[model samples]
Target chain A: MSGRHSKHDLETTPDDKLLRKLEAKWEDSPTRVLRWHKGLDVRGLDCNSAPGWDGDKDDGGALVAAHAEELSELQERLFADGRSGGSRSVLLVLQGLDTSGKGGIVRHVVGLVDPQGVQHRAFGVPTAEEASHGYLWRIRNALPRPGYIGVFDRSHYEQVLVVRVEGLEPEETWRAHYDEINAFEAEVAAAGTTIVKVALIVSKDEQKARLTERLERPDKYWKYNPGDLTTRARFGDYLDAYQELFEKTSTDVAPWHVVPADKKWYSRLAVTELLLGALRSLDLGWPPADFDVEEQQRLLAET
Target chain B: MSGRHSKHDLETTPDDKLLRKLEAKWEDSPTRVLRWHKGLDVRGLDCNSAPGWDGDKDDGGALVAAHAEELSELQERLFADGRSGGSRSVLLVLQGLDTSGKGGIVRHVVGLVDPQGVQHRAFGVPTAEEASHGYLWRIRNALPRPGYIGVFDRSHYEQVLVVRVEGLEPEETWRAHYDEINAFEAEVAAAGTTIVKVALIVSKDEQKARLTERLERPDKYWKYNPGDLTTRARFGDYLDAYQELFEKTSTDVAPWHVVPADKKWYSRLAVTELLLGALRSLDLGWPPADFDVEEQQRLLAET
Candidate 1:
């Protein structure tokens, strides 16, 4: 309430001021509270709800736009920190069913920052080379280097979710992956990479609507997959698989955040807010110059 | 003058309409005319000049902004094309001396598009692993996959430019890189990748001023390098090296655009325009649906 302002006001405010104002308004971090915990029922969650947001699509869009500058600036500082000997980075893991807005988050939210500072990888069905290695091998190779915001469109959890539900691996094989993933994530987290695991949950009804819309538009056909329909047939199994995976893999080092993603705008806003919170938690300062500034200035003047 | 309009008009027009209007205005492609030639003298090029643009900073900035949506859309179409069985991609190779605005172009120009579709790699000094391989090995590995725009901050040209000037490699070794690079680029271009090579040319005076500015700002300190002063001392040598480079390697397949980059805004705008022209030349259209749309739609509706 303290930082309440019209969209126009938010647009015109200077970056630091707007960032501070938005921070004041979002001090409680509603999106952060969405972190997955034991006993949380995935089946009971609302698909279309916007959690702490009460605005329409336009207002939600405006809020995301307002956060753009702050997010961009924070990402730059993070990059600068890494360039100046800081090894800290953030990894955002996106897992969702078909048409659950994983690509949308990448376009609308992760797209807000400098591309130089982001490492985005979309993992589809593993290739021959990838399948030859451990499941985490490709994920390990895709981890963001120091100073980057690494995005995994579909990530390691596919091992537990799809691999489990589809019986691509034996139950014993897939079940052990939960602990292996947790251990891997804990190691990454300890080595200065903050992991943000997000599951974008859309209802079966919403998924039908989305897939129908994709089929209705010629421009969207490339995004459609017949395999998605095959996967959709076992929707209940996927939910159960995700529920068990969340319970086993959401750890002290890196917990999961389940976002209701029927509304594309809200999912984007929520992800952006979650990313903002992760970055702000770094509490970075501009890396100081190791060289003598005045000496460099004098040397340059002579040149 | 076909589509010349005020900045306000550009900001308000719809995306497709604006794209058409701007395409008409840029029909002659001024930035493309800046492409390096066999006899062109790199030393004689005016670093402060804006080439075809006569506007001041505000207009230049507006022009770049106007191009943003169209560029973003074209990039998306490029991505879509690649996603739906197209192999074509764009590689914007940015080679410049210290303080020449390579990073700025990546941030302001290529940054206009989706990060999901961008593969950005900044090649610094070769690591032991990189050094152990053939010079082009890392370059090959970093090439953009289908559906991506790859920006190399400094590219293989460093072998010819810095390696030659700094005596890092013997003259015969560095000299042979020209044909190797040309052959390498030809193969890439033949494989459906359009390579846009850019050399951001900044004068010695401008470099001094920019370095001094970096030294003056605490926030920019990390960007400054003491070694840059050492490089500045060899400015003329670099120009000579670049001149010879253009003569030897400016192929029909991957011609270099030597941009005068003293003004940051002009360089950013020019690079944006050059990239715009490259994407436009692709003559891309949205990929059509691969599946039976009506059948898919019916199935989704039943779901």
Candidate 2:
């Protein structure tokens, strides 16, 4: 694995190095992924451009529009194969802070797949009946069948993110979930399910602007919760809690991709690439017909 | 209302009569709709087609491919709008019997929508926990948010379809869900969610060929369950069950469009039109920004 990494880590390969650099830079700051994981002050990032930014908004929009089409096409092909073949499944889990754009990401990424083959489950406040069961039960039921793709707007990671952030559960209970999630995902992957985990990262200022926008916009007023303001105020604590989460749970089976969500288009592009990249790795294809073609043709003609 | 009907029915201009005839001819057979509502009996469908019936096989393939590309491009536009605006949501529900081409319709229809705006939920047997709650609870929770689109492979209608068919619930419980569903969908629509419901109707002979192919193909073995045969054998009971469902549940609020699934391409085409039609009705646009053209021009000059 290290040798494989070294091959891709060629000095002349600027793209690989740039990606590595971005990942490292994100790792150092750490706060973005943390805010996403801890669920303490989950604020959505501003996707719109900043005033006086260097980029031309038209060009930026065009680039995003093109990429969106590519990703959308890839998702459609993958979905068609999955629905028809019935051999494999895919699960995309998004964990992000309040307004971290988990919903946004899902709206964009899973939206590309066929509604027949893809399933989306948003884990909110557990119902009394759901709460009665073990923590992972509801999550388990939401898993897609063979040949389907399931997207979790918020997922089993909540046991670690929210329960731990609010101290709603004992230390041991939340801690146990990291292993449990990894195990559950492993089982899923082993059953031909591809799991992609993403944490939508937003900066404090970006979040503040979004929350303010939400309050001002009449159409968006429905999404603004009064409690969210208090959550936003404790931003630093949320950061720390999330940083701890990323370090512990990011694993080989289901690696966490920290999406730079301040640029919503960029975030959507990255997530789309991540998913398409995963599907490409699967080498999916239409299943071959079983019987002899000529014989079947002859038989049908006789009938 | 009767006068309006009489104008089209008894005394119409030639153009109007042609239009009415066209509409009536295109309207799906109630029996075809029932075949989908009840699981399909694939063994019954006639498998007698001349050489090369598969759409992917010839000159017909070229035409279909071109048509698909056009649909795909339209879908690309929808996705761009969905990601940017994120204001209105769409829900497409596909309900059909085994081999009725629910998956096929999903593949084809979803092939047309922007992946960023659509969420697909495939509802199956409820777990003990899910069953404990009202049947529609899990389905409702999976509804798409504002500016998103949700597609359900099997939906809340299962309360009427499966529960009623299997005698899992009393007549009153399953029967009343028709009104309950209408109310539920109305609420979602009021909340900016557009519901597009489709029942894929495949001929009995087309179904038989599909089942035989499923049995013969190793890769398709996963889709072939022992229960499907038992269900297929009881086709008449299922048809009666579904015809009643369609008659009672099809309403102006969220009318059920029956797609001809005998031809996979036709099914895809019909569903794609129905879905795109619903989205088209939304009249979505980019959020208006307070942009000053002259000020922005000066800003660009400075850059």
Candidate 3:
């Protein structure tokens, strides 16, 4: 069949024939959505998978599982080094909508890493004291010290997201935060602190589905906040604001990745990739051997 | 029951009630034996009830459980304060025998604190790379930044304890470490970091009981090392060294608390009291109200 004819055939077939669909996508890799970064218009890049771009979800899951393991190993090695040297450190920021899988993503990323070296922080509504300080104050205090990896569940972006949506601040003040955030991230980057920011963007429909699941399961009731539905009512506004802010703020110093959060598996995969990409940027190594043999012998004899 | 007869009865009884026993030894406080201080005579403190004071323990379980709840509460309050403030921090150091409840203490301390503001690190044997650096380099790096509470499971004391025990360094070198540690801790204290040091001491009999349990449970086999038995065999010498070290090392700057490890409940309670004393010293308070009328109006408008 001609290339054009094969492409046409793919468009009408049922998706269960995923192997055939993937083959066609690979054949058309140069023009496919998965490889759609050629133009580099990050804004225009169609993150959504079309007929050909959609492949085996299981493959995606497997890829995530594999990469997560690899990343976890790297994270552990980094942690071991940091704990001993006690100098360099890392901070991972997870910014995603509800059910974008912040908690799950953290579990996978640091699953194999030593819990000793990794710190997890979940940012909720600011307390009255947190509000007394600048928006970044609470977050600034939460950054990890040397030789550790700090993970933020919902980070300082609440300044731009919730505070903005809630009209907690004047338009002029909150609008200025994009630059302020960019500056803050740049400062952390300069401090030998590596910051990996991930924005999990699930579709409005997916969010509603997750909310419904929470309502149906008694175990998930703690996660169900009636306030979230009120926020759901303004979902479109939140998305528009988030998209604009993300576009304006993603930078070379601290780039932000908008992961396709509709599928938890895919979200996990993209996040692992992002984390590996960030950590790989750092050239870390194991500590060298330097015990004094005679001294060690003497100490052993004393024992 | 004449007073003189009752006092004579108490003197002859081997085991008094827990609180009374503790009070009887309050001024002497053998728990202080585990602490780093000057003037302790480990060899002299050797007795059946004071087994941990002379390195005669195979288990420290009861000592660990004794202080779990209070330590748990203090950790919780520390993290809560951290969440409220944008910049404040604390550090908890656990140093003890091979099975002196370091791991158990870490688990209990961090159990209730939010994973975000609290980071736990267990420092063990130096790697090839770590041995090349100054002894305290690795530990210095793990200090939590502002608004964090970093727990060190083993910590820098290995220089004085294990290193000295193993004769890894000259007497001059290990002896010098006490002052070095003092200076280092003073600096941390000056930096608004509240440092709590706990040493778990278990009687040899108790240690043997725990070792037996570890052997009986397949899952705990990994925790038992044949080398520790050798250390136990030379227990008297180790105790003498520890006692001398603790007596000379414990100072007004950073006082050491030698917690009895035979009864987990008693040990846990002592740790709780210590933490409560430390945190209570900080004078933490809720942030004053900060929302202005306009901000309240915005919230009202949304409502």
Q: Is candidate 1 or candidate 3 better by lDDT?
A: 1
Over 4 Å off in model 2, which ranges?
A: A1-87, A183-187, B1-303
Clashes per candidate, residues 3 or more apart or on different chains? 0, 21, 46
Candidate 1's C-alpha runs over 4 A off are A1-27, B1-27
Residue A128, model 3, lDDT: 100
Candidate 1 residue pairs in backbone clash:
none
Q: Is the docking of candidate 1 incorrect, acceptable, medium or high quality?
A: medium
The TM-score each candidate achieves on chain A is: 0.92, 0.75, 0.79
Q: Mark the 10 consecutive residues where model 3 chain B has the least summed lDDT.
A: B51-60
lDDT of 2 by residue, A211-242 (tens): 76655553344455556655666666676666
CAPRI-style grade of the A/B interface in model 2: incorrect
The DockQ for candidate 3, computed on C-alphas, is: 0.06
Question: lDDT order of candidates, best first?
Answer: 1, 3, 2
Q: By TM-score, who's the top model here?
A: 1
lDDT of 3: 0.61
